[model samples]
Target: MLSEGWAKVYITVEGDSGDIERCCEKKDSHMEDLSLQYVNLEESENLERHRTEGFSSSKALVVRRGAPFRVSLQLEDRTFHPKTDFLRIKVMLGSLYVIIPVTSSKKVSSSSWNAYIDPEGLNLQSPSIFICSPASASVGCYRFQLCVFTQESQKAYAIGKFILLCNPWCREDAVYVPFEDQREEYVQNDSGLLFMGTPMNLVSRPWSFDQYEPGVLEACLNLLQVSPWHQKNTRLDYLNRNNPVYISRVVSAMINSEDDLGVLKGNWSDDFKQGVHPSMWTGSGDILKQWAQSGYSPVKYGQCWVFAAVMCTVMRVLGIPCRVVTNFNSAHDTNANLVIEEYYTETGQKLNVSKDSIWNFHVWVECYMTRRDLGPGMDGWQVLDPTPQERSGGEFCCGPAPVKAIKDRRIDLLYDIPFVYAEVNADVLSVIVSKGRVISYSKDTEKVGSLILTKAIGFPIHQSITGDYKHIKSPTSSLTSRRSTMSGDSTLSRAGSSNGVSVSLTLDRAQVAGEPVCFTVKVINRQNVAKKMKVHFNAQAKEYNHGPSDAFWETHGVIKLAPMEAKVVHQQILPAEYAHVLGDNLINLAVVVEDMDSQERVLASEEFNIASPHLTVQVADSIVPNKVQTASVSFTNPFSHPVSGVLTVAGAGLIQGKVNFRVLSLCPGGRMEQHITFVPSMVGTKMLQASLSLTNISSTIRGFKMVSVHGA
Candidate 1:
């Protein structure tokens, strides 16, 4: 550790080939002629020191490329008198060396290493060594040596060796912003965003973004394949740094399969899964570090929210201002046509095949930057989706879509603005088909992109910014207009003409696992005469990526309705009937009503998900930065057989690295307890997350706890 107010010495020596041997000597030698000896160099003050059993010098020095660094040195019996002795500094990498001459300093500070000396010989102190790395500096470790020479010996003494490493986020090469608050939030890792569950509203829910882990930046660089000596061909290589092209490449590569180094390999399944909860991912740094340590294999199984949250970490670590955004009732406009179509059989069974569908919600990232590549109007927040939903430039990635362009409905803009635009503004059309022919149908124009949101900075609540993306139109206005347009002769002829009958369906309450599902079906007759109708009800549990797999239950009944009158029929499905096939605890129910007298059919359907109980993790006390705290986790095994696996705990500043606990055997229905002790190294809102995995059962349960850490 460097002492306060003490100046360090750094000497630079330059000479011919014959002088190299003299400077390389380890011991000090006294010569009759003028000579330099006792030269020593210490590692930079910021590098972490690891002391060995018998060694005092640092094992290595890690320095970020382009970061301003200082080194301290000392010389025995040799005083660097400005007028008499000439000092030279040689920076050596491999066999190459750059000779730098020592000159008088203009100004010096405690943190600076620039050479500074007094006029009087006795007042003169050691030379202050300051080095500013350029952006072109190759990243790697190098050795530096200092030498001194006099006119008589014509040789320089090599007194010391210093190790220097170049890292990615160097101070001199990265963009410099003027606002302290913005800089701290974007570059300093003070806060970050994490998404949980599915999106429920247009406004983003509050998620803690912790970016200040010690290895986070290093891990991020690893993602980009950036090292001290080599730069690999990643998405980052496609564009210039600090420009929109680079930003677009980064956003696209984040979720796309173009780069295997991408963090998320998306998988949506109830069983044979990994990472059950997005909140269990406490910070980007730890996640990235894990990937690096695992030999750069992409982290297993991530959905939209996970991809977006991790993207926020990488962007912020690279000094790019970023945040996570959520779109509620987001449409997956698979066909590039702003319409999501659903098909049903005459008996009300929903067909499993469709090119377009809508997701409950979708999460993406937005980065702030000046769009020098796109010219004046594009400077600001650009939408970027790490989710590999759509392809751009033959790769699975989206955006850098200018928010301004999205708001203005500039579907022609670069990237995937049209895809993103339809995510919020797409029209949904439900059509009924009988005998392979289209019949009655309805269109809901306001269903998709119902809400767009991001968390408000410095707040624990969601901030709705829907107005910034699209104007929310009245549902009635769009519905009436769409009905009129679809009621044209062409549409009516395509929809088999039948005696006027309308069918609608509604659920009694939210569906839950191990519980009955009850719903109501209503049939209305518009004809003057009474009519008989056949009603069919079917429930199927299907995977999100594929068509309906198996029918869980089915029922059909007959009903008679009076002229211009409506009749309601109620049905209940027991849990045992569908529980076996309920793959992610989700079921799609469809109901169809047919007028027996006219052979006309109407269909209605609904999809619901059942959520499982989550594990619980709690902190024992209030947390202060740099202070240790205890966290306890409790998990109850719901299985009937014994389970055993690993429980892993991780957080950005809460722990240095991931902590793992082993479970030998947990009895059926038994509760497992784990206590973890860690020290919070940063002050802010932080998250501590843990996951319990049972290899025997092939199940994983996750939980998280958020705490505010105050400065010590």
Candidate 2:
């Protein structure tokens, strides 16, 4: 409570390690440092008694990292008299973060307050905060304080203050951060927070889309940013050419900046990460039919390229941006068919293709999405070539294996499908591959070879669709950014072959200790003929503990594999085996892949790991619905514990409010349902959100989703 014409405001900063400071407008400033760490403002200088004619101070001083930065003013209380409808506080964070407007635990009953920043505003690049006091006679010269905290942090970090003055000039000063005209686009007056849209209608696809017009050929430049081909081409050719003519033609035909669709780099989006499968694009359109009939993988001449392009195209067309990636799995034994050969072995012997030594090029795509559904339009990836069967009867079949040593392994050449192949080996003669016949190699293999072409292959459509999608052009290009498995670039000379060969295994880490030990095995093939090999592994422990080891490391399954193929095995060490090895423990691991024809040895190895478990945190059911919305906000602990902490909700005009709850005391691992009743005066269609932390567990962070009121 204060005099008729006087108002008070509070300003605070949490975790102000760097001493974030803000200058106040009023010459006389009052500073209250609640943290007790230090107080910068003297108590007597609290109010700037003399008001400038306009009642405006220089820009309000504020420390960047300081919390609760505030100011108070002396005014005629008559200005805040009756008919006052609402009290509001505006908040803004200089940087980007999800801000939550929270009120002080100490309740002020006489005045009502509404919030500005809503849940939708949380999605903005950076948003401000707003608190509105319900306009009423009790508002008098009340102190309206604004508290803001990041979504990641439960506690308030920055605080601001203002006086609820009844005078008109005083009210204008509170809303000064953003001009009144811009408020519609950036914030709501009642809550002083941003107005983010609804969850189903979240804002994405940059605002630039709104300004796009057909007249601006430069709009075509948008392709340059979304499409990788444009990015590279604009760099190599159009870096200086901003001419309208060039933009029109390039944008009109949508000619990617790099190569044609059939010969593009990769299809995966830039956001793709490990463990996720790449997307595939296939359609029955006329353009796709023409491209697929050309002995290509429907999109490009190379399977890897086609896979990459299709993956990328699907993601882009669906509004997810992506980029092509290129890398060589030199230490990867899982993908040998993609290896490029390297000539001149360690012994100075010309390299050859054997079942045990080979490498081939490969390609795959990746992406990231708000949700885990596959594909843009609920339709996920459909198969064009259903029931695809690999060429049988050889060291290389459906799995990783030598290319030349296998009969009918080349899907492009073996089928009546138009195919292309280049011989990089100087010793490779003419290669004649026929179905059911071992491929015969001659020195003339350097000559360009074309296989029969298969056309009009049909695919079965998957009934299950996931994300939203729109039909665009069928993928008709190949992404070539991935490295060639066969690292060999040597030009072909006279034909000659050697039997000398060598193999090596590279592990992800030489040392690792944990409950689950995952590592990769890199197998290099240094031979000529397609070599069929077997990799065998065994672990040696001190006391021969065998419970979990028998279940996980038993050698019952066959390890038959291709040359240069690497495999990453995730091994979870069981609790029983922990006693056998202590510090610097040694264990033997072996890999053995044999040459199918000669039945000769290829690889053997040893590896080890230090085993231990680490504690981790995770949040469950992040999207919880607000079932009952009355006097008290409530939620059930989906987990098996007595979750105990504060639950919060913001949005749809709730700025400064309070919620009371009765404990349901549900049994452990049981459901306890209850109903909530809020003051009927505060009902609306806007989303009401709340979060209550009931568990002390570090991983107990919760998210309230699908929030709705009882009547609304």
Candidate 3:
């Protein structure tokens, strides 16, 4: 018989690692000795567990490694003696397990995990203790159990599960991020910007990461549980979960369904009746929830940006700092030759002769972590793409490809560093073909990686990070700081091999949707004699990722240029001629010159994006939590005809779920204003987003406003 009102609790974990078991086994004997003479363990209470772990106001029990979190233990029997009874905690993930003694006298290795009874824990009817996992603990869902060991007997009680993740806030963690502000923005901010459109006409589109939302964290954990890596080899996956490198690669693969039963099914075709269009998605919450609730079946549609943004959410939810990045003129070299070959006719018409592609802007995520697998100095931001463009290690996922290796051209490293290097550094080989033969060809080494953009820290604007990817200096316009993708001045030029004639294309200015396609073709003759040439000007509508379709507009004319003469021919294609053919709001404009005498053809082409009309989201600068706040959405029809569609509004901390309503019809250039109200439930800087999607037009307009919420 022992003292009353005392209960001993212990948590035990199962694992194949004998080192952990030996460490835990040695501590258990010490704990048994402490039971012979009891000791009261106490620790200072911390109310900011959720805040410090960046999961405040979130529903899941997500704590970072090396951080302590509390678990309340309720006992059915209370008549136990403190000297003869104690507690043990058991936590298990896959085959790795450990049994932790909560008493301070049995303190185990600080390099692993530790537990302590927080002040009279065993003396009370309901015991509350602090569980602290070492910085090296594997990241995943851990099954927590509390077992009572009394002098007479021992019994185990099962409790709920908690998730452990990498700790960017812990100095001892491998994923540690030193700065407080960057940690907040990268790991905590729920919304951000995704740069799209062309480098000349950048679009700062908004995206809701929805990482802190309820069920999102759960879904992220569930995602890992359902991944092929975890399903095929749980032991290896669980053991490697401690390394961010392996976790990121698995997550990148899980973001698409081509290789496994993953979260999203990528759709790049025209028909989307079976599922939602890629452009209609405003946030990752709906996509992730749909994936989890539907028996892990992949969600309908997602593109590069959506995949990257969703991966960002998963990385952030797992406590790894992440951000979405866009590369203008991103190349996809099909043959691994480090060059993308493009063929065009003498009449400025693109020929589908190569497997290569150049996306106007390709989006992916950059996760911040130390790359122990790739050696030192390689640590920092590593590019991870979930678009399923290429398969690495026989799986449809790419990278943790170190950005440092990319800049230094160190392709002999692990992951997909070579693939990523070619994406930004590939040479563009433009060939002119006439009569089933190559007339002339030109290579542009600097064209593929013209711009790389990411959202600035603590601000909604985007800044150029191009220099980080490419070591060499860029063109004149590449260095200018960009707040909005609104500005432009990039030029395009290609010529015949050492010929006397040259052709170049330049945009008078950035072209916008619903406006005429405007640009000029300059032809120069350096020969000492006059020459007559036939000019072929062509315009074709294209997706940012695919090659140009049939030419929507074309013209042929004769021009005469004397020696030391330069000519600029202005061209325009009306909105009526192009709006119907646009599938992805992008166009390929080209002009080819055929020397009437020499028959040598020269080509110059420029790919430009027809930017969508901006959707305006406005709300009060400061909103009170738990109080109703009004937000307004404004949009003007940029088409030639009346347009109508659905308008969706979403917010993380500002609104629950999402609100959708039918938008009234609006004529060309007609403006529509909508107001909606919702009561916020949390305090912080939150994004209020509205998206206007149309069924007829191929463009989606989006807007987001970041507002500070006042605490109640």
Candidate 4:
């Protein structure tokens, strides 16, 4: 932080340890002004050694335990004589403190703290010291103290303070990641993509994890400190911080304020006036800063993706390899029967008769670590959901459940494997109920766990990890499997066709906002005589996990299908009708064909998202770190009337909290261009994300550009 040797940094956040006040209490010295105590914290050099660049912007010295980082000891107006004086470093976290003596010989321990004078600075006026912490040391804010022992006097002074995190770069650490590239991508990369939309069409939303951004890292550390585990038993929480499994579970529970005072409060309704809308968030910096600034009040309006993305930021900040995963057609089997029941009326109205629901897409986080608790082969990527969908172990948290365990159906394992298993492998029962009586029903096996997606390493594309969570050939019901192999549409997962009459619903695959929504329903009759059927059609906009909001379109009519013939009916709803009711949510479309003569009805439905208009961000293909670069963002209002709001640009390792640009107004179909300059601080591939929030419509439009920062 200093142009000379090093600079002392002080930092504090909400829920920070009490010892920090003591560490920074005072610089009182036993000796006179002739010899003042000074410990220069070499943040840049130590950050490289500790693999803690993610928090470089933080005022606290962020370092991972189990690694040796360098610090310079400077005593004013004093000539150091190694034989006459001895130097020691005292580290304290809350009620726990340890004093490690500085020795000439290097000492490394997996169970205790150690330190030594750097060999290169042995003869220098300001000697550099290398401090080492045990791999099992508790992770949190620590007060650094220096004790100088001389023949004439002994003095201890508060020197500096730091935050300790899990050491993924240390082999002796439980969270150690062996591969360099994997660590760089998972733990170091502060920007990522969160997958959304239906399984048929995936939307990659860029997210700035903002680990290195100012104050974000402090907020993350504060989250761990204020957790229920830490609050209930500080000693136990400190001892358990070494394991990624424990840290992940704690983070999962702390990301959402369900039963505790965590970071985000979950909200799925249309209203988000108390705080920022979940969809408006393009980065974690603002949300985290708000939480820390608001005295740790849970930030309003967060859904699954928001929770998962913030959790990923926290996990990565703690040096755990983490990524976001999205499961399409994700089922929430509340009864644990692994069956999701969806009821429909004979007239094609969806009835919320069952507590179970299938989210069109659900987001969660996956952390990578050695699973020593679950035994061998159970390591690798594990699912840890921050969304408070259900309670596990008396807390509204889920996982630390291994993806391996989920895929192998090892529900007997620890940490809510059954719940995660049901999320991806549940069966759906499409039941047509009439007057409280089941008329016809069919089971769908391929619907759930249709796809599991994560952002690919070093690429913007999505990587399919569905096989990592479920078998390739998941078992299906006999009736459904028979129709599945009948060679119709390979991409479509359909059921209930074997009931002699087949019904299928298809939507215009390339549906977009500001355009007419179109779909077709095809009904086939295999019976010999003419089939007279009452056709029922309906559509409603719905949150991915919640029930439908208001109906956008519906119709009832009579139709006739000739023997052994199929009829297709096309339907379209203008943009004016649905534009008022859509924003990152999906449309639930369903139809029921009732055989009036036979008094039988069949149901078919599909869920799809309307893609929002894209904003374009242009930046140079290659950028130099520490050098200013200009980027332009252009957006054209797609909707009618004038729109106005704030446009925010943010990127971890590139920009600070958020760069805001005000937009007075833009007429319909009018383009707006904004150019901004920023200096990229860190190297490697970093994402520059821009988001436009429209206050008039309460909508957010997002765009991102990946820049390769090659130079130091």
Number of the top-ranking candidate, with lDDT as the measure: 4
Q: What's model 1's overall lDDT?
A: 0.59
Measured on C-alpha atoms, candidate 3 has an lDDT of 0.79
Ten consecutive residues with minimal summed lDDT in candidate 1?
Answer: 48-57
> Candidate 1: deviation at residue 22, Å?
24
Model 3 lDDT tens row, 508-594? 777787888777777889789899999998988888788888998899999999896989888888888888875356888888888
lDDT per prediction?
0.59, 0.25, 0.79, 0.80
> What is the per-residue lDDT of model 2 for residues 588-674, given as tens digits with 9 covering 90 to 100?
343343444664443323223342211111212222234323333334444333434444333322222424243445444443333
lDDT of 2: 0.25
The predicted structure with the larger lDDT, 2 or 4, is 4
How would you encode candidate 4's per-residue C-alpha lDDT over 6-33 as one tens digit per residue? 5543222224543333322333345432
Q: What does candidate 3 score on TM?
A: 0.89
**TM-scores of all candidate predictions against the true structure:** 0.69, 0.21, 0.89, 0.88
The better candidate by lDDT, 1 or 3, is 3
lDDT string for model 1 (12-58, tens) is 34455644544433333434343433322334344322111111223
The most accurate candidate by TM-score is 3
lDDT of 4 at 473: 70
> For candidate 4, which ten residues in a row score worst on lDDT?
478-487
